[model samples]
Target: MRVLFVAAELAPFAKVGGLADVAAGLPPALARLGLDVRVAIPKYRAIGERAQDFASAGTFPVTMGGKDLTCSVSQGIIPASDVPIYFLGHDPYFDRRGIYGEQNEEYPDSLARFAFLSRAALGLGPALGWLPDVIHANDWHTALAPVYLRAGAVDLMSRSVLTIHNLAYQGWFPIDQAAAVGLNEAGRKLVASGRQLNLLRGGIQAADWITTVSPTYAEEILTRGEGLEDALQARRDSLTGILNGIDTSVWDPSTDPHLWAPYSSTDLAGKVVNKRALQEALGLAPTAAPLLGMVSRLAEQKGFDLLLVAFERMMAFGIQFVLLGEGDARYASFFRDAEQRYPGRVRALIEFSEPWAHRIEAGADIFLMPSRFEPAGLNQLYSLRYGAVPVVHATGGLKDTIRECDPVHDRGNGFLFAEYTAEAMLEAVGRAIRLWRTDPEAWRKLVARGMAEDHSWNRPARQYCAVYERVVAR
Candidate 1:
């Protein structure tokens, strides 16, 4: 089967979030199953530097506002996989410093940029003389691909599958701009939602199949009415929530080069060494205080506001806190102030470092991810692999992945709370801390069990393959 993946970001090449990781990881896994899978993404400024070899495949004209805009296609091989990655080169649209935008502002021409990308992706198969059986589009960026396909842009024998990584971003724009992106009367009807052109809604309406990251997230979107719950409910029969899997090769603690000491589930002594190393690196006193690690975008959706509300109280328990991430000026400033207010107790690296992420996962006794609504988090899965007991809110993939620690049965993997309040978060953290301070044997069992579980892409890949087959059959 021939599959073409259309996404905004592809990991190691272009990445803003987990969407990139999914685009990069899933294609290779699909290829291993004997499916001919390829990925198509815009050739952004950052990707040009890392993409090794690139030969021009030719240019095609995309119609926008009754004018022909030329888009060049370039081919390159993914470093360690057999999957081919196609770059849609349009300097005016994608040759920017940031993929979506910079400084917490989206570019006004985002509609034109991604609309061109969606049209260009559909144009690639015909240009290359290799029509795919399935075209899998990811998130709002490439959401218009399914719309384009259904609008008779291409005559290829292809079925479209749209995966909603996060339903919050719906690629909304003024209805006036619809015609510029080739949204005809029919396309506009599918996309229109109260005077706005909803790109994700268009995809959901046109795609043969719709999928979200996790089963819990799939059900939550329908119930939460997160703006598109009505549209989602309309196509409930077609929607399926497939839980995302992490790339084990990249997240494995045993072979990770960023770790202070490499260790597996069995030899947990290295975890203690890594903890001490992290304590020294962050300038925190090497006491037995339970170290809480957090690596996330400092935004309200990630529950940073709640964390800030309970920060002082949580710190009063004598637990050391370390944070590494950059997002939202308010949260960034607050966390930086926390470092100064409580020296040696709170360490906030207001930036993103891949090494630090791995170190934190390996070193910290407990990882915190109290997201208000997480689609499918990779960190909690990584935390489990590293034996870092996760203290996540019971929602979305966090609920799917982390089981609440059962002290009696000694079967659960992590600590979970149901509510989205600061008090609830503190209570969950307190539970984890109590487990760490009191019962060493049970804590070891919890960590060991988490590490033993499989979160690899193998099973999810097979599930996706089955979905592909079903979609193709339809």
Candidate 2:
């Protein structure tokens, strides 16, 4: 079966968050199952080589705002896979520095930009004479793909599947702009929310199937849908929450070139070497304290505020802390100040480095994820593979993936805090620290248990294929 993936970001090309990783990981896994899968994304300026390496697949015209505009198409194969990736070029709209916006300010023309992407993605298939049986749209950026499909914007009759990565970001625009994007009169009437047009709602209503990143997240959004809970409630039967999987090759500690020393669940001596290296490199004293680390976008949703409050109490435990991420100016400034307040105890790298991320996962004794609400976190999964021993808030995928450590049996993988509070977080960390300082054998068993578990895309890929087959049958 031929399936087309419409997304705004693709890993190693254009990326902003976990969605990019999902876009890059899932397609290749699906292709291995003998399914003909193709991905389509906008040709942002950030996509290096300027399309010089891609094969020009000619051009197609997308009529928007009653105007027929031509769009250039370039095609290339995903690295190390047979899956084809199509790049849709519209220089005036997508040729910008940042993918979404700058300094927490989204591009004013985001609606028009992504609207063109949805229309262009639909047009890309017929232009290349390789129409797909199903079109899988991701997030609000490509949410309009389902709306366009239902409106018959293209010649092909493709089933549509919309995946809501995070419901917090529903593309809201002035209802007046709907006509410019060619939102049909019927769709406009249904998706209009007071004087606003919600792009995600439009897709949720139009798509044949809807999915969220995790099973727990799928259930949580029903009542806490930001503003569209009612809309989601109306279509509960169609929604499914599929847990996301990580790219084991990229996150594997045994072969990770980013690590100071390679280690596995079998021999954990290299973990100690990497941990000492991490402490020395980050300017922390090489003490016997348990090194705590986190690598996440420093946003409110990621529980940065809670971490700030919890950090003061956590310091009393004599644990070293390290953070690697870049987001929210406020959070960045606080962490920068933290380095001064606790010299040799705290290190916050205000940048996003893939190699550093891998190294941190391999080295840190305990990985912290205090997210208030997470859809499906990849870091926690990566931490498990690297034997970082995650101490995450028990919500969403974290609740589903992480099990509370059973000291009696030493069976469970990680620690979890049920409540979303600073004290709750500290208590969970305290449990892990106690395990580390007292019972070293049990700690090793817990870490090894997490490492032995499978979090690869092989299972998620098959789950997605089943969804695709169901939609096609309908």
Candidate 3:
């Protein structure tokens, strides 16, 4: 089966989040599973000028605002994979320093930018004679792919699947701009009083199947829109959630080149070397203290406020803390103050470094991910692979991925706190610290068990292939 993936970002090219990771990893896994899969994304500044293995396909004319606009198409082979990647390059929209907007705000021309991309993707299927069996679209950026396929002019034989990585970002455009993007009369009628063009809603309404990242998240979107219009509830039968999986090769601690020492379930004594190295890197005193580390976007939704509250109390307990990320100003300032307050105990890195992130996963004794609502986090899975015990709030993928330790049996992966309160977070941290300080045998078991579990994309990829087969069969 031939599958075409339409997404805004792909790994090592233009990645701002997990969506890019999925776009790059899942398709390659599917290709290895004997399906022909290809990726299509807009050419942004981060992708650089010359694309590897990229060859010009001449200019294709696209109409916007009743005027013709020609976009250049370039094709490249995805590194270490048999799948092909197609890029739609145009100067006006995507030639910027960042993938999204400069600040937290969305780009003003985002609607027109991605609208062209979606239309171009559908238009290319016939032009290039590569008619896919299914077109899988991700997020609001590529939400118009389904709508484009449903257009009468496009003789699209492919069924479309829409995956909502996060329901928070629905592409809202002016009602006047709807016609420019090929929104039909019926679609326009469904708009609310604002008459805004809700691209995600249209895609969810138009697609043959709709999926989110987790089962809990899928259920959560029903009553709570999360920017997904009430139409989410209307299309209840079609919507489903499939939890995400990590690429084990990228996250494995046993062979990770970034680690100070390589260690696995069998030989976990080397984990201490990584821990010491992490302590040194964070400017903490090289003591045998338990370290709690976090690598996430510093935003309110990630429960940073609660983390601050917990940390204020946690500082009295004498545990080391390290953080690495770049996000909102308020959180950054808060962490800055904390860094000054506890110089040797707390360290915060305001950047996104992949290698350093890997080191954190390999080294930290405890990983904290207290997200208010996480769709499907990859870090907790990565932490498990590294034998770094996770102390996470029981919500979304955290609940799905991390198994809570049975105090009686002593046979689980990590610690799980049910409530999203600061007290609950501190309690969970205290539990992790107690385990580290007191229970040697249980700590060894937790580390061993966490390392033994599988969180690879292999299983999830097969499940996706099954979903593809089912959708095609229908």
Q: Could you say which candidate leads in lDDT?
A: 2
Off by over 4 Å in 3: 151-153, 189-193, 227-229
TM-score of every candidate relative to the true structure: 0.98, 0.98, 0.96
Task: Write the residue-wise lDDT of candidate 1 on 1-474 in tens digits.
Answer: 999999999887887888988888888989999999999999998866654678778888777657799988888877678799999988998889999998889999999999998888888888888898999999888888898778775566789999999998989999999888888787888889889999999999999999899999999999884688788899999999888988888988889999989888888999999999999999988999999999998889999888989999999988999999988989989988988998888899999888999999999999999999999999999899998999999999999999889988988999999999999999999999999999998999899899989998888889888889999987
Best-first order by lDDT: 2, 1, 3
What is the C-alpha local distance difference test score of candidate 3?
A: 0.83
| TM-score, structure 3 vs. true | 0.96
* lDDT digits (tens) for residues 412-435 of candidate 2: 889999999999999999999999
Q: How far does residue 113 in candidate 1 sit from its true spot (Å)?
A: 0.5
Error of 2 at 338 (Å): 1.2
lDDT of 1: 0.90
Q: How does residue 37 of candidate 1 score in lDDT?
A: 92
lDDT for each of the candidates?
A: 0.90, 0.91, 0.83
Record all residue pairs in model 3 with backbone atoms less than 3 Å apart, i.e. clashing: none
Clashing pairs in 2: none
